[model samples]
Target chain A: MGLPVSQILLVTGFLLILIGIWGILAHRNILRIIIGFSLIDTGIHVVMVATGYVTGGTAPIIDAALGKADAAANAVDPIPSALVVTAIVIGFSVTAIMLSFAIRLYDAKKTLDIDAITDSKW
Target chain B: MKRVCAILAVLMFAAMFLGLVQAYSERQARSPLAEYYLTQVPRELGAPNVVTGILITYRGFDTLGEVAVLFMVAAAVGVLLGSKKEQRAKTSSTDGKGPSELVRTGAEVILPLIFLFGAYVIMNGHLSAGGGFQGGAVVASGVMLLILAMPASKLDHGFLSVTESLAGVLYVSIGILGIIIADGFLDSHVLPLGKFGTLLSAGAIPLISALLGIKVGAELSVVIDRFRS
Candidate 1:
């Protein structure tokens, strides 16, 4: 059975998510964990955009090239794409915050290892 | 032991995703709302890009929230990294060697072009695939180039802050004006929807989008600067 492009995208997105999860769990350095989290964020974006794809559909734009009626029939879902823009910004913001925290932690402790900075752990 | 655990976790995730992929199907216009937007955007908003129309007009509040979130993050990062001691430590650690002549010249030449492209993207948001968010990122990249290529030359933090605040205030004021003069808050019907597919079309959408682009660009620049120091 030939796998659909959407399914292929989904699988790739999921694989990225898994690799990210593994990185976050396996790595001891704080930066590695942050990198993993970003990978997961990217994976989610890919999955979301992929889910909106329609076979043989064009972008959701109306112009002289594509009439309004034809656009409604052929355009892919626009909501996911719109939402993904916001998601991307929010993800960037979160990543920035995490990196700042990492920097502060490194400055204070002089180490990036997660295990070494566990004085607060009970 | 951790390696084994990681492998097991990855395998489990792969299995779960495989199950999901098995049940997935791709089709055109799955949701009724998607159909509605695809149909009504051009007729109502006079814009060709339905995603831009939805982002800046139909669901503007979410976009506002996004801007607010970025603002908060910038603020938080500034506060987190603003310690005088840390600043001194960073400055003292780095040697005073600036970027090479070639890099400086390239950045100087490319910066204006990046700004122009970003402006174009924001201006034509209603008519094409790009919009405020994407354009804002391009603008931020320009700022990033400045930060990297000319680290000695300081960006005017006060100016960036003022621009960000003014753009944010204007965006909200436009929304409030929409509530008074048009259908509702953040409504794009405040201005006459000009010729379809034209730059002037989509009422306040293009305006709001431009403001959003400026705000996002400034906010990201501030964040990057904070991270640098």
Candidate 2:
């Protein structure tokens, strides 16, 4: 059995990362740049999770069919799924904090334009 | 100047590519510990997702550091942007109009379902695709809906703070429990592993996921409350 869906997801995730990178480079607004960063983070998470998918593999739980004696016969790798949870939480917190920064920047400068906020006199 | 920057970037990228190729060609075979970890960790940990096991158990110290980083960032943002005087000033000026009827109604209708789905994701973390992060995000989204639908002044700050602190403390305590009760730090097998695919089977993963959900929800709510318009 081939994991065509997983492959597609991986490719799509890569495309999203590329698009997000482009957006980060091209956008002039700080908010859009932050959004691009979020997109890139999400794309990476998708790619990492997709890497763990095994064709015809069952969930990582121990199977009764194989019994306790040989429990490894059917499980797929559970590590990536667990790691992705931490990544997601980190990403959410980061995004929230970044958004807060964006709000503060907007408050200070009265502008969301990235070019307008540059100053060495801080 | 832009063209020069672009050319320099391309050259740097090419150099990195060459460096990566050289490194790959010269890399040694996997170590015995690496092979043992790859083969043995999943079976022993009873978690299907090796990454989850690594994050929550094997390298839990790193995960704790990551949470600290998040908390510090949040605190830094709060300190930098938040002032009692500024908050009071903004509140008076920006008693902004409430959310539209459509948004308010929609959010009210969907928030409970969203929260239930987040709980489901957290509870089934071991057996299914989701884990703490995904469930946490889902819970955060539920709070986001509430923030969008209601006034910031109306938000229950006390409840949010209690939930956040409780979750953070619980997460650390669970890690400590692993050290005290099990083989080492963040050893999830401290609790008895039930038959396997059941909700209670993964020892502490579901518990961690639940704590994560509450922490994320509180954090995101705090973030949203800070931005009133």
Query: Which candidate tops lDDT?
Result: 1
True contacts kept of each: 0.91, 0.23
What are the lDDT scores of the predictions, listed in order? 0.89, 0.67
Candidate 2 Cα outliers beyond 4 Å, as residue runs: A1-11, A46-83, B1-43, B47-51, B84-97
Off by over 4 Å in 1: B89-93
TM-score of 1: 0.96
Q: Note the DockQ of each predicted structure.
A: 0.81, 0.26
lDDT of 2 by residue, A1-122 (tens): 55365666676666666667666776789889888898889988987766665544455543344343333444444556656766876887688778877877776898999889779875
Q: Write the per-residue lDDT of candidate 2 for residues B31-95, one digit (tens) a residue.
A: 34433444464467666444455666777777777767766765766675566545656655666
